[model samples]
Structure formats: structure tokens, C-alpha cells
Target: MRPADHDELNRLCKGVKKSFVHLETRDSYGTEVELPHMATWRRGEPDDFAWLGWWLEMLRGHRAAGRTCRRARVVSEPVSDYQRWTMSHVGLFTDAGEDIRYVARPRLATVPLPGSGDFYVFDDELVLFLHYTGNGTNLSFEITEDDRTVRTCREAFESVWALAAPLHAYRSE
Candidate 1:
């Protein structure tokens, strides 16, 4: 299925029975939707979280359904402006029940990652591979449920999650 639209993610969240895990392996996301906030954060704005209510609400609804929503990000140290900006918003999602964390690039020096970049695993079964161009526009998505694909992504996420530091700790250091 083409998960190009936002509703598809909502549907997937609704269908998730056990858990939903998202692995984001990028230092910067050049998607236009996030550029404005990234720029704001780069300029040292005190309100980097003015735009995350909707996402938090969605996560709250997902958690209300008795499902777990977790996200782990893989990033290089001295994180990019975009990543720092993104992290500022992680608090919102976490408050709404998504377990969020970050794994420094060096920590996974010998470990391998699944797929090319980011992906969302729903119920640890349906894997939605998020494909992005060099510019990070989130251009395409490939969804699959093949046992190997699901298992690989699931394992990859678990490993990263284990090594990742929670948002508060990462920001404090």
C-alpha cells in the first residue's frame, strides 16, 4: 500500500494492536513541511514546540487505544540544526505516550541498520519503508509484510532503542 497520505498513518495506528515503532535515521530532513520550524529553531527561538499539538494529539489517541508508540532516531553527534529542532518536539510525542530516544552515530559504529533510512513498523508486522531523496522530501514509501523484512526492521529498531538515550539526557549533554 502507498502510505503517501497522512490518513494512511492514522489508519495504521488504529490497526496496531501490539506496538508501533518508527526508526528515523537522518541528521537532517529537508522536507518543506519542516523547514520553517527548523529555521525558527536555528535562529534560537524559545518556542520550538508551537507546531506539534496535532501530532501529540494523534499519539495520545493511539495510546488511548492501549497500543504502544515508540520512536528511535539515529544521529551523528553535534547534531544538525534540523535534528535539534526535531528533538525539541519529541517531548510532545513522548508526553502523549510515544517512547522517544536518540542513538548517537558512534554508538552504532559496528551495528547495521535496516533499509536505506527511516521506516515505520506497525504492530511489528507491517513495515512501511520511507524513501527519501538526497534532499529529504519523503518522496516515496514501500510497504511490505514479508517475514524477513518485518523481522529485520523489528530487530534493527530494538537494537537502536536499547542503545539510545532518552530525550532529556541527550539534550542535557
Candidate 2:
């Protein structure tokens, strides 16, 4: 990496500090998003447009902030080629210095599609409402002075992250 590249990388990691909040469920990837909040339950299938669009927006936002975001999905079953493809697209952005991240950590956490999760970026007071449900899933959120929930959520994310496998670990067909 060049000098600028190194600086950018530093900035990216800086976004994830001790205060980032994250919410994931038992069916982390399968939970249905309520279109209203970022919590998960149980679900049938993944919403293609919603999932894809969320990835796109997240990548753009992270890129805008000069940082990278890594995702680890622990599913009950193996992911399909199509699912892998969607994930790969996010990975491509990381190649462009956008810091894209994805992983398949089976059985770690589960959240139904259309559920909600929040991530609070500590340094900048950025709280991301992550809703993975509905036709046009929205991660509607607000920044608040209360950091308790955010802190807990971030800890949860780290717990899952610790157990998650790297994207390269899985060989997609």
C-alpha cells in the first residue's frame, strides 16, 4: 500500500472502536426485517433486492467515511452461488480501497430477514440502523446521547466477529 493508502486504511479501521453497536439474532441471516426496526426473529427466504441494496448502500457509506466494514454470516445451511455472488460484489469494493467485508460463520448468530440491527461508530458518533427486510429496506436511525445500548450492541458484534470465519475460508460453487 502507498502512503495515502496506509492513511486511508488507518481511517477505515478507526470507525470501529469500543463503542460500535450491533444486533444479531439466532437466525442472523434468515430473520425477517420489520421495515421499521433493526431487530430479527424468524424468516422463510432472503429478500433479494433488500439484501443487495443494503450491501450497496453500506459499501457506499463506508467508502464515504474512508473506512471498511466486514460482515460475517453464520447460517444454518450453506449459502448458494447467488448468495455468494452478492457477497463477492461487496468484496470487490474493498479492492478499491473501500474496505468491504463479508464472511460465512455458520451457526454463530442468526437473524431473520427484514430484521434490524444497529451499529454505533464510536469515534464519530455515527449510529447505523441496519434493517435487512422489505422491498426497499431502510436502516432508519438517529444519533443519541445514550450509549448504553450502542455499547452493548458493539460488544455483541465483536463476539460474533471473533467467531466468524474470513470470506476466503469458504469456497463458493
Best by lDDT: 1
Model 1 residue-pair collision total: 0
Across residues 51-170, which tens digit of lDDT does each residue of candidate 1 receive? 666767777887887889888988888987778777767767788999988888889877778746798999877888888888778777778888898888899888888898898887
What lDDT does each candidate get? 0.80, 0.42
- Kindly list the per-residue Cα lDDT of model 2 for residues 10-114, writing each as its tens digit: 343354542222333323333243331222112334334454454456556655665545544443346543344345444544453343223444434462222
Each prediction's total of clashing residue pairs, residues at least 3 apart in sequence or on different chains, is 0, 29
Model 1 misplaced stretches (Cα beyond 4 Å) = 1-6, 45-51, 171-173
Candidate 2's C-alpha runs over 4 A off are: 1-68, 74-76, 80-82, 98-106, 109-115, 118-124, 132-136, 142-145
TM-score of each: 0.87, 0.46
How does model 2 fare in lDDT? 0.42
